[model samples]
Target chain A: MKKVSIKDVAKEAGVSLTTVSQVLNDKRDRFTTDTIEKVLAAKQKLGYLPNKNAQQLRGSKTKLIGVLLPNLANPFFSTMMQSMDANKESDVDLFFLTAPEEDIEAGIMHLVERGMDGLIIAQMIKNPERLNNYLTTHRIPYVVLDQSDDHGFTDIVRTHETGGGELAARHLIELGHKQLTIVQPAHLTSNMNLRMEGFKHYCQSHNVATPKVIESTLSKAGGYAAVDDIIASHSTAVFATNDEMAIGIIRGLADKGWQVPQDVSIVGFDDIDIAQYMTPALTTVAQPIETIGEVALQLIMDKLDSTLTHRDQQSIVLPSELIVRATTARANLDNS
Target chain B: MKKVSIKDVAKEAGVSLTTVSQVLNDKRDRFTTDTIEKVLAAKQKLGYLPNKNAQQLRGSKTKLIGVLLPNLANPFFSTMMQSMDANKESDVDLFFLTAPEEDIEAGIMHLVERGMDGLIIAQMIKNPERLNNYLTTHRIPYVVLDQSDDHGFTDIVRTHETGGGELAARHLIELGHKQLTIVQPAHLTSNMNLRMEGFKHYCQSHNVATPKVIESTLSKAGGYAAVDDIIASHSTAVFATNDEMAIGIIRGLADKGWQVPQDVSIVGFDDIDIAQYMTPALTTVAQPIETIGEVALQLIMDKLDSTLTHRDQQSIVLPSELIVRATTARANLDNS
Candidate 1:
């Protein structure tokens, strides 16, 4: 099959190159309505595919948005990406960049070099100085989602992470679990720190003793390690910052023949898809993942349209609810 | 914050517009190597960004490969995408398209419209006629992975799916299980069909009775639903086509007070990351996910280089290994 070109499209439409170019780029002000209609008819007749790359180079919006996610395998971020991909069909297409925390710079540069019009970045790097420099220097339109803090740029979307922490603590306290421990990732961030702070504050306000806070990896192995720490401390309840770690704690406990909610109540954050379906139907805080994606995309669109800017920095804190599943219950007197 | 153009780059490089264009498009064969170097140096010095879209229009290659995966949240596929992204770093970048079986055409057209130079598709669709049509019509360079039956389109990379199925069945049979069941997705594809065939074939050859087979979704919910069917049939052993579904099945069985291996043995495929961390450390067949990703990307590279064509329909099936974990055990005659 012969490849169709701008000349073929113009010839079929009975229009000049400039007129067809204007119509293809939607520069309708430069072309008459009749010319636009003729070009459309010819485009359909010849099945002419417009050169998208050329149009993008000419400063025509590609309607393609790039999202740089941390890990697509992680259900939390993957679910968010899925929602954005499904919901942003009317005006924009989405491309994704997946980077581990260690490869943040490479991921950022990948999208930047691709000539993406807008970006939605959800990564937690140890330092945002490079990212900040890049964002500030380029002034590319962007929205940051679920980051620990502002890198002094763009609109931000966040959950009420601290609220979720408080709810987890309060739930354990209400269940008559006094001795508590917070299991967290080894590398602390403002995000994890805030949750820990909220949990501590809740316990203090309720006249309960400050719970022991143990730092571990946010992975299953980390949860397994937390088990030994819990056993050593003889804590009645363990609060994991994320559902993965929380479930890991459950698995670790089961391996040790320590029953969940009976010997030790476990609470986790980020009610991922598998949380509810876990054997104990994990007791955790549900983050509004889909809503977060929708809101973040909207914020990016607004920024691209010049409706929002860095000054706006719209930090949205969606409510987090504690869902009591089989993981948490009244403290067992046997262990106490 | 004005946008920079090729003319600006040429002026900075002290070269003619045509020379700059040639250098930018890597048409350096027409010019002296020294002249090409000078233009490139000037481009970097001036931070001159090439208009990728415009260059893509004039060039035969987009330097963009599209990867159409089934689900981003599935660890198996997500990890594959991650590794592919890592390996495809020398000038070729990736665009991602994800669609369900029903949305295959939309996905194909989406990638086509974006001018993808080639594609690496993991089409888990039941009926691939639409998928076959789009790839054929466009003569799109492609490499299909994980799906069964090469649609006679070359550049295919598949794991030993049937062999994996056979291994799962033999594993159960060796454990003295006579009655078994296999749970697969509701929408059956060649992938599932082949797996079922492998299982049935092994059962027949070994004089083991063919067990019950239930079709369910590839999700945790589907696994949950298939449990009642397994329970009703009183199968001593079950095989889940994928690890996620198997995890779901285990969860469902535990919910029904059925102890794994003691009363029934469960096995799953696609030893995903979470497989080792499952409560019973899922006994399953492990596909070489990283190798599949690398091979698929290499195949796409082959297609882009015109070293392979659709008529070749070369299929590469990597072997799978059975990893025995805590999930499967010798059938307990005491239950009988």
Candidate 2:
């Protein structure tokens, strides 16, 4: 079997090789309809397989993008991917990179080796400066999908993580809650740390005691394991960073003969779809996932189109809001 | 910058091109350690980017596999992916292929075009013959991950979806539930249909009134929307195919002034990570996702290693069990 080249298609269609290449590559506006049809028919008949590597070497785009995610199992990331998938304009393929690595430098190198045109980095943990410098040196087009505006110098599509933290605290404090606790999964993330800072600062300024923070896994098991310690503190209110942990806290409290809101109020972050359907309907902070997805896609597309240059840096921040529901209420005066 | 060929590395290292190629690949045992180091050093110093297209044409494995899933946002799929990641050998990269299409023909084509070594199709729909024929024609090694063994002829790794469905029905019937309902997501998946078939068959044999079936999206919103219709039907027990719907049922029922296990006993399928964390601590059927992942990996690995042939078709069926928790209880005689 021989590889079908543009010359073969041109000879088969009785047209120039340039015409065949242009027609196959969406540059058919200059050609007549009959000529375009002839080129396409000949190419199809000859069983032409496009040499993507050769095309990239010839200044033709690969139409391939890399998506780096910390955890694919996390629904938040999936939502972002789905949003991008919906906004796709062509046959662009998205390669997901999740290798359980602490950082994505090696992953980025692999993507570059594979000839990716751009990348989207979500839920990052590495320093912004280091990554920005590396991407800049490599001439890779990328946007950081984060939940906070802590990225000092880089292209970032983020939600107001600090405002979200302050909103949760403000809502609880206004409910007359004196004893409060913050439950976060794993260590404090870049956004989680900012949230913690904002939460503490607001409490201190208002003359309220700062809430004790607990670090655990982002899963329900982690939240379940910390139930005893949380109960021992006798906090009237709890703010879990993500919805998964907050749901676990509710069950653990239930097992210990405690009722939510009536005994202990609970608030969660990332108002995922399931949050609204939980028993008592969790009160949470909503991250604009769809907006982040759309903005991230647009930024990467602009870079790919050469409209956004390397020197052009952007750090667009979206708003994160608190959604009050059945889980939170005025702290029982006696419990406080 | 010029392309560095294997010959260049050989010339620099003062070794044969064949020796350099062999050392760069798996056949390194025959070469001396000194020679191998020299070849590697020369290859690195020249900044050689190995032409993967040429390597693939020469029968070198891509070390890339595609995992085709119906929904990546569903944590069940993520759990399977994580399990596969844990069982990963060497540096094989897993690319997630998810399109909004119901059939995976287009997705399969895209993966093949991108040069995937193999594929693992999880939560598959009906009709194995079409996919089996296509895969066989293309010589692409693949295994269908059905939750039920209703496939006509193909390689499949599945759980006892029939037994799972029957187990839920048996538990509800034993609890004195007469008017029951099976709430499944969508129009009965290949696995869900079998579960429904088994559940209905057992009830028919026992002279018990067969439960009614409802089709909707596999989300909380779907379960919430169907609450009124289910209550109007006077269903004392409800069996949701997944935990998402079951959780929604509990919340929807509470909104309608009914309590789980008191007015209605609800059982869910796929005891996901958040199941135990639900306020009522959901009782559900657990799919052996880890076992499925391991088995699926083994099947694909066997194919890649040439130990498993296309003629060697296997249909492995694993058992599933019911986990009774706080969500299910003895039916109230008054309600019946």
Candidate 3:
């Protein structure tokens, strides 16, 4: 059977083609209630199938939002995606794009070609100038979930990395641990930089000597290697920027006959899922990841609605609390 | 600027509207070469913007494939999704739909309404008659993954679950474990059924006492409870249907006075990425998850091409292999 078209509906209603198109697209404000009823009656009689695929492009407002995250394998972002879905009240379609650091440009191009009206990017690559260039060209409104203050060009949603650092540092300082170090990734991304800044601020405020800072990859192997320098310098506490590295440090320390919270008090960030399940539940700062995704989505929706126009470069810095699990405890002052 | 329409293109090319549409939708075989050239020239000259969203509806094909998986938090399925993207040779768009048991019906309907040409579903729930009913009603071509025999209904793909079970059973048996139990989900699916059958067969063929079976939720908590039961019953080895449960069992054992590989040798299936990174690396069976996705896509493409038909229900059974890791070890008979 031939599918019913707009022309058929117009002919049945004895109206102009434009009248049928307007009714189908929900632009009936231009027509009277009586005319809309006639068009609706004809559409129902003819079994006219409104073209959804066509409607996606016909309007300036597509009601489709695109989300570009690093990878779903990371539980942090995966849980955030779930939270974002749960917080939505409107019927908005979500398009998720995953790209590794190398192929981020292609990923951005995919969203642009798809004609996404708004974007939420949680990217961790160094020097995202290429990405910025594309956004500038496309003119798609977006929000950046960043770690450092370097995101001056985009609306940023900041995580309290510095607060988490100060919390961890103060805990150790109160326990009389003078020898300490901060473990982090080599790159100066916002996540790591904010954390380091927080740690430094705590030391300066407390009038303690500057702590040693160790840079390494954000992996278990890096954590394992950083322990060697820590032991050599007789540091009593280690603050890892992320939980994965902290877990690795614990494993490495244990292998070398060092007991957690007994010889070295360790603190990690991001309170990852597996952290609680670990043997010595990590003492970490819990970042509210779900809030980030939810607020980001709301921000984009506001921009799409034309109520928001890059006003004040709003940055929401959610509070982070120190969750002192078994990994951190009273420092043993006799170690020296 | 007002969006250009097909009517404008037709008038510019001095041709009928249908002729211009045919050329745009790649139905050029029915038109003359000169006519095709004229339409192409007119499109380029007028800067004709063929509304992709509308064109998808008027055109015969959408070039969009929908993939439905159980959950993204599971590393196994996430890895499958990642690899599937890397292997796509064409510009096929992938739309991901997550089907929790409660929302599976609604999810299927949503995908159908979105105009997905083909589907690849991960059958996590039993009794797919409702799913089958939906497919039948829509007449949409689809392939099932991680499920039992095709039952002569649809294109199906599966891992050699039975073979994997037998290999795991043999490994445990050779290590001198006579008392064993297989832990799986509460309800039986085809994949779970096959794995259990293979395990029981191995025990029977070796003239060992019939092995015990435990059915619980396929979760960490379930694995934890299963571990307590196995210990109380004095079972020396346990085989979990998936990696998450196996890891749970390991943790449970540790919580008690039992050590992994020393007290209980455990085996799991679907060697997800985290399986290798576990504290005591997991020994389990590995499935070609991404290959299944790629194959499922190929099946749908074939159906679209009309090269394949419903006359024969095509099935693809991929192989599984055993990975030796720290989780399993030679059983000690002193405890027995």
Candidate 4:
């Protein structure tokens, strides 16, 4: 098959060259919704992979994107990687950080030295100033994915974490759950904090009292170990930040002969593959993991291609929603 | 912490330089059992991280190892990656192939151009000869991980796949399962084939009828979708090749009003993190995933360091075992 070009897309969409360019760069708000839809449809029809070859600032493009992520093995990250791979502009490979807990500065420096055009990073660090300085000083084209950074970096694409938290809380509250336990991760990120804030906002606005927070790891083992505390709290419903913990909670509850949604309803975030297949089928807040990844890669590609008109640092927050599954039910006041 | 060298380990083990080298390269057969134990204990004590610095083969030593795998998000692979990360040489980093299914040849070529010292591959391909030729012709130091390759590659570190198959089958058969169904993946690799062979061999030797094979993806959804056929075939026991399928089987069975072990016993391979925490707690054949990864990385490091006296090829097959959990029980003949 021949490579589809931008000219072909423009002609097919019946739009001006600049309009097509703007639409491609996610300037959808500039155009009417119908025009944006038309351009996208045309691009889809023409099978146009963006021609990023026009503007290659870095000498001889390496066709490699470096991805630095925290908790590399989660389903969410895996799905994100898959999406990024599928939506790549051309034949490009990703250089991944082996351990996010370690010094990521070295990894960033290594990727930069390797002549990669751009990078996607989402890892934790105590000295953010040092990392920011390195990237800015080196002028490496990069974006942070699924991370909330106040740093004046190039760009970051994050899920609507606060919305997700609020969605979960509202779902539980509407189900008549008053006494709730929020299973928080031991190592919290800004996104998690935002999620908690959203949940708190919803609870407070709805006249619900402050829900107890149990600091836990996002792993299944962590959730399993927190069962005693959850039961002891006498809460009717539990909102674990991620699905791994919720699954563990369910299993842990089952081991103790308690039924989900019957004895203790549970809600989780990141509707991972296993969540839907669990015994009670987890009720979760869906994180658009793949979209975030795809969009982040696109932004990086646009930046590398010099298609980004505005050089100012920008953050894109996508929407999140609640997925009601079998694990949650109306609260049982008598049981509590 | 100070860097521990091989010399330090040798001194601690009360062994010569050559003895330490042999032990590090897994030449355990060449030494007495007591000698091997002492060397291992010493190495453990001294904390030797395989100082491949002694013998460097690459022009400048890029210190980047490329890892290619089939599924990106599996717990088994995640655990393996974690182990490899933990054990990697201080300066070495891993460059990962996100989607090995699409044009791995291009990815490998790019990694080679970028001067990756060596590669670790585990992906499905139609023609193994072509891939092997590319590696050999280019003189790229490479090793196949998890997947079994018969194409005389430099090195392959894999689980005892056939043994795993036999273990799962035997566990089910010993439980008095007269009717069994093996949920095989639609796309079978050499490892999966070996697993089936071992399971079949066990059944034949005992004069038991050949268990039917149900072709499915080695994912939860695939296992769940294969349920109707499983029930239709009236199999009392299921031996899914991996835990994902087994979990799906359990969920699918539950959705159809059947209970595991009591109605349909299920056994899976790879004893992933979630297996032990499942509702019934899955019975699975455990693949030493982390060990396989560590050993594979060691082999690659050894090759790069020119520690291998014979430049021919090496294949290391590690042991696999069955962990009987709550998912299996005595066959319900009455239910049948």
Per-structure clash totals for the candidates: 4, 1, 2, 0
Give per-residue CA lDDT, model 1, range A4-52, as digits (tens): 6778889988989888887887789877788889999888776677656
Q: Would you list the C-alpha lDDT of every candidate in the order shown?
A: 0.79, 0.76, 0.75, 0.78
Q: Compared with the true structure, what per-residue lDDT tens digits does model 4 show for residues A1-336?
A: 113456778899899878888898777778998889888999877655542322222133536678877655677776777678668765566766644565677767766655455788877555677777665545567788665365655588888889899999999999999999999887777787888889989999999989999987878888998998998999999989788888888888888788899989999998887788777788999988788888888888777664455665668888998999899999999878
Q: How accurate is candidate 4 locally (lDDT)?
A: 0.78
Best model number under lDDT:
1
DockQ winner among the candidates? Answer: 1
> DockQ of all candidates, in order?
0.29, 0.24, 0.17, 0.12
Worst 10 residues of 4 chain B by lDDT: B51-60
For model 1, what is the C-alpha lDDT against the true structure? 0.79
TM-score of chain B of 1: 0.82
Q: Is the docking of candidate 1 incorrect, acceptable, medium or high quality?
A: acceptable
User: Interface root mean square deviation of every model, in Å?
Assistant: 3.4, 5.3, 5.2, 14.0
Give the distance in Å from residue B283's predicted Cα in candidate 4 to where it truly belongs.
Answer: 1.1
Q: Model 2 residue B22 lDDT? A: 89
Question: What local lDDT does model 1 show for residue B74?
Answer: 77
Scored against the native two-chain complex, candidate 1 gets a DockQ of 0.29
Off by over 4 Å in 4: A1-58, A98-102, A307-313, B1-59, B98-102, B307-312
